[model samples]
Target: NLRVHLLEVEESVDRVFSDDSTKKAVNLLYMYPNGVNTVSSDIQGLTESSTNLGVVTTLENSIEYDSTARSS
Candidate 1:
């Protein structure tokens, strides 16, 4: 019984936002995919600058990565 009610509520909420404007109002939580190479570092829960985290990866050239995302 509880599950059925929850499903109905979900459906109603979806219907309320089933419009172009509502969709546009929501900010995307994802970044766009790109072929460019860039250095990444873990800055989560840290107060230091990103540079202090150390370079995780970098671009070797116009078409290659100096280090992969898995390299540590």
Candidate 2:
């Protein structure tokens, strides 16, 4: 439910996967944050894993409520 938690999760995933471990990295990177925001928060430190990461975040929130760079 916190950014720190998200960062922890990201780092944990990063630690276990090697450069060649694309699938594992992608799966970890695709994980959604715990809280919902009216204006989507910036998701940093994550590699481009799922092609629909942005899309999934959008649909979960709403066009007006969802902008990856915008904060709650």
Candidate 3:
């Protein structure tokens, strides 16, 4: 269930980022919890500019499960 949900979220994010208008408007940093790792925008000088702009976009999922396989 969680895996499926994460996949759906990833797909949605990918769709949004794939748009040309959105890509030009913002810098993005995407992270996944299970297998797929980090995905970042291809903006030039992102590190320097992002730090100067004091803007950050982070997508994180923290799911903790107990030994009984139930969410905690």
Strongest candidate by lDDT? 2
Score candidate 1 by lDDT.
0.29
The CA lDDT of each predicted structure is: 0.29, 0.36, 0.30
> Which one is best on TM-score?
2
Steric clashes per prediction: 0, 0, 0
The TM-score, computed over Cα atoms with residue i paired to residue i, of candidate 1 is 0.19
- Residue-wise C-alpha lDDT for candidate 2, range 1-72, written one tens digit per residue: 223233334333323334565464445554643233343236554343322224322232232222253232
Stronger candidate by lDDT (1 vs 2): 2
Q: What's model 3's TM-score?
A: 0.14
Assess the local accuracy of residue 7 in candidate 1 as a C-alpha lDDT between 0 and 100. Answer: 35
lDDT of 3 by residue, 1-72 (tens): 122132334333432334664454332222222221223367543332211122234334322222211121
Residue runs of model 3 more than 4 Å from their true location after superposition = 1-18, 27-72
Rank by TM-score, highest first: 2, 1, 3
TM values, all candidates: 0.19, 0.20, 0.14
| Model 2 residue 65 lDDT score | 20
